[model samples]
Target: MKKVILTALMSCIFQFSNAQNDIRIGGMLAYGTEVENIGIGVNAEFPIIEKLTVSPSFIYYLPKKVSGVSINWFEFNGNANYYFLDEGNINVYGQAGLNYTNVRLSYDGAYSGFLSSAASDGRLGLNLGGGANFQMGGNILPFAELKYVIIDEGQLVLAAGVKFNL
Candidate 1:
């Protein structure tokens, strides 16, 4: 079941790649409250129409200690962003999205206890921030954004990365 879904998703992504013009791929470093640790992510932006873009991103949070267990967390997000300022080489946008979060817990002690446990949850969030695209006469744009996520809890994320246009 998972393989089928993954294959279908890959197929759709390839099709979208072939049909899009303003596609950007980038990586980011993130930190938040619930995450409890620094995270890393990669994202791709596909322009659906003028001033509108759909971005899919994946983030993996570093393992952190909670109680007596080590927890690993990650999330997948799909966001729809609308650009209100798309003039020249700089663009500013507001984003809203849905996220699927997963967490894995494990205990490290003399006695192996609860060897495996995982939990997954989904949430809808909004990113109320804008970023500047600095086009240095190339296909790469350096951008920085500060966004707050409103979900089960509020989290502030600051991300800086270079986007490759394809």
Candidate 2:
């Protein structure tokens, strides 16, 4: 299942490369309580239709000690964003999508344990969020976003980044 999803995502990126009206690539700093850590991410926004865009993002959280366990986390998401105000320097948008998250845990200097087993499982979740885009002169846009992840235990994410139009 993971392989298929990854293949499809890669295909979409290549297929849309030439046809997309606008493409923005950027990096973000993310914080979420589920991982109880800060993460770094890269994202690309591709226009799909009028006032609508598709964004693919990946985030990696550094290993951190939490509750006596060391944890490392990562996530991949594909989101659809609808711009409420598309024709201005400032745009507010709503986004909804799906994400796949993977976590690894270590305890007592060993990786084989209940926490490791549970954390190694892949989780699929829903992502809902909103953000604002501040377009600077030319092709630079700085953005801030907030998103919620609905899974076993819900998580809230806050991210900020710069988008470069291509």
Query: Which runs in model 1 stand beyond 4 Å of their true positions?
Result: 1-19, 111-128
Q: Write the per-residue lDDT of candidate 2 for residues 1-166, one digit (tens) a residue.
A: 9999999888877766654747889999999888878999999998876578899999998788776777889999999999997657889999999999998776663444543333467899999999999978888889999999988898899999888888
**What is the model-wide C-alpha lDDT for candidate 1?**
0.76
Candidate 2 has a TM-score of: 0.79
How much is 67 displaced in model 1, in angstroms? 4.7
Off by over 4 Å in 2: 1-19, 108-119
Clashes of each: 0, 0
lDDT of 1 at 51: 74
**What TM-score does structure 1 among the candidates reach?**
0.73
